[model samples]
Target: MPHSNSKCWDFCAPVAGILFALAFAPFDYSFFALLALAFLFACWQDISAKRAAMRGYLFGLGSFGSGVSWVYISMHDFGGAGALGSSLLTGLFAGFLALFPALAGYLSVKITPINNGALRFILMPVVWILVEYLRGYWVLNGFPWFQIAYSQLETPLAGYIPVCGVYGTGFIAALSASIAVEIFQIAARCDISLLSHYSYRTSLREVHRDGPLKNLPPLIMLLAVLWGAGDLLRNTAWTYPIGEPIRAAMIQGNIAQDQKWRPENKINTLLKYKRMTEQYWDSNVIIWPETAIPAYLDQVNDTFLVPLGNDAKQHKTDLIVSVPVHDADPDKKYNAAITIGKEEGMYRKIHLLPFGEYLPLQPLSGFVLDMVNIKLGNFTPGVINQPLLKAGGYPFVTLICYEDAFGELSAQGLPDAAYLVNVTNDGWFGDSIEPYQHMQMARMRAIETGRFLLRSTNTGMTGIVSPNGEIIAQAPLFQETALTGTIIPMGGMTPYARWGDRPVIGGAVILLLGLIGYRRFFRMAY
Candidate 1:
């Protein structure tokens, strides 16, 4: 049977979800995440586990449906999927992501009901963050988008990134939300008690006599400490700059997605990039966006890259550019980044975008995608332990497209990698917030590794991020321009770069186990 207030929670849940999406980039109302989570946590209270899960699913729908709506643009506008097909796939993708939060709500209630105040507060936040961690790394080759911690890059909670990475920061944020709801429940005791299965009228009357502010001071203090400590930590430098700043330039070609891969437009595209590069010959290092050369590496290696390399060497400047590599085996092609002039090296992308780079589940996914008239690449994955490529005489890690979203992957190149370079072509999702959201995630990587992040993207958001996650410089969206910035290569690793996500995830696992043990002991004791 549905509870009396189920309708209210059902309505509020999705609204809260929309607010949650607003807390992230482009909208960037950071505190809205806290409010949204608090509302959702409050909704979970006094509801059946099933009802909670349903409301959570609805919240997920609202959040991802709005947050990642740009997926439809990429599929329909660029990938040739019609509007109906694109909408269906986008909705399906959002629906699938919603299951993560549904699992969180269900497990949270089943583990510890809301009536047990102290236990519920701790267990619920732990369960929520563990589920978030799972959704980020374990599911679907890892889509770490819209993780609550990403929204906190501008907040003091960003201080937690260098210490414990995204999951840990997210855990703190979830804990803050849960605690806020508990504080409200304490203040408005009767309202929550009336909604629940139990009648606490007499108990509330006694508590009312004592006043509602009895238990709030400790929680308020704790909240202050968490945020205050984060602010203090923000000033702590985890990595130190080691050498003279290198003058780097990033070229944004603003190539139209539809015309980018056309055979006839290849010459024009090459000429445009060459013309842009010729102007920055004095820069210590110059970068081009992903697959700047629309054709295969072999097709233009002799006629184009060789002459460009010779010119770059003559000018004593290093060039870093991305192109598709056609290996001897046709099936072994890669989306690779190559360094020329002062050094010659290549780093093939290790983490391939599922469906975008290659279809998983082989013939099954291929057939389904074909039915929707959506075409995807069939690129090969590179080895994980590939050597770092050098630019401007400094060894740096390179990420192609969305790979920077995986913070631990950026850390893997650490201590050794002096700075970071990410080449992206966000042109597929035209005139949308996807590029901005992507840039936000990339900034989080710079914080985690304490290294300058040089992101060269086609069409929009070509920029440089400092070690502290601030944008040093940015090129305007949809512009044919070059972003010039100074990058000081840092020589130390942030705690996150050294330890990765193990401590945070391991702590969550231990807390969950402890909760299970406490539940069993409580049952036995009673």
Candidate 2:
């Protein structure tokens, strides 16, 4: 039937996935990711396309299962789904996410040169990145948690972000891991005769004692050169300060999810935020977390918003707060951030969380809203293009919660928007690593855009990230506090903001074409 050892490799897939997840925030063992990727490459090498696809599927299950485990906490603990139901649903979601990787693995293996070592190595990285890009670009409610480049944020590879975006940085990372596998294959004295079944699968791309092994030293040196280049470019400034820095404050409410939206707790929530906002009136600007107000803007406009706006104007400060805005239909209700006082503007969220905010399938929207017993469940997505929100005389691109994760999407206001403001409610995730991971993603966006990113969150990670992705100041998780800091508005744009992910995808396409051309023309001539 099947080779006995093949069964063992199947289990290794999940372990490899776990190692990859361990590379990101909360774990911070980035070296483990290389090992994990190498293990996956090793496992797939020489295996049949079907077998490799199966292994890849298992790898994805492990990768997303551990990396996004916080999803379970959100669904059951906060959304009120039963533990068993949450676990099942989370499993299904991960399963769906896994298909992207599986698609890459299957297609990579299905391609010709199934026996060519250099060709296969080249193909793997290109295909992997193509899949990652597709996963994020697809309208199927993209969940780009822990992009490979994100793990490289602190590494020299991050220097590639401004030049090529996350995908290009990820390409370098994936290539390094693949090269490592190649090195191991060469050093282990893996001659064709002495080779095991594992080596056979990988041999098409690997150097045997006399074949591709001779090329290893040069390849290694090339890798060293790439890494050295990244290190050199890592700290270079892409954007500069324009006007005077403005003092800003981020208010973290630490509101519990279950009690947050209750009609009884609505007044208390407003009072809590109001009291906190008044304390920060001395600052040039005050920011409240996403959905900081439990009620719609209309419900409190006369009594709360107008008065707060007047007080903020009188105090010479700008106040921005998140609450619901319903023009008509509950399904048309929006998750919006409105600025009050000196510079007033409203930014409704464009990227929305499916099922969490609004069900993608319109028919189920009402049923889910009724079952969830939540007023904001049927919220709608915001407009595509809106001018930057002016706060403290600086233009800020405001992102709601998960929108910051999509760097390119956040850059839509670029070259015009001077800074970034992200408001999120991480209370749904409880005191888990989700907030930290989310904040890390937000920081990367700042680095990419060459603009300061200020994040105010409900129950945690209220902080300021500098243009270079460094955290200047942060508040404790699950704390009711205000994080105040001075942020300079930047005038110029980073390469990433000016261009976007186009360069990366464009380069990938060119490389893929070259590979295809070389394989057909050069090999056929031989």
Clashing pairs in 2: 45-201, 45-202, 46-201, 46-202, 115-204, 116-204, 117-204, 117-205
How do the residues 344-420 of candidate 1 rate in per-residue lDDT, one tens digit apiece?
99999989998899988788889878999998898998999799999898999999999998988999878999999
> For model 1, what is the C-alpha lDDT against the true structure?
0.90
lDDT of each: 0.90, 0.83
Q: Estimate, for each residue in 1-526, the C-alpha lDDT of model 2 and write its tens digit.
A: 2232368889778888988898898787878777787787777677777888888899999989888888889888887777776787678778988887787778667663655778777878887888888887664677778678888888888788777777888888888888886777666554655445445456554543346457777778978988998988787888888889989999998999889989999888899999988888889989999999988889999998998999999999998889889876644788999999998888888988877786765666555545544343767788888877889888889999999988788789988888999999989998788888898889888988888988999998899998878999999987789999999989788788888888888888888788888778756887
Instruction: Count residue pairs with overlapping backbones in model 2.
Output: 8
Backbone clash count, each prediction separately? 0, 8
Residue range with the least summed lDDT across 10 consecutive positions in model 1: 190-199
Looking at candidate 1, what is the lDDT of residue 10?
Answer: 92
Measured by lDDT, the strongest candidate is: 1
Give the local distance difference test score of model 2: 0.83
Q: TM-score for all predictions? A: 0.95, 0.91
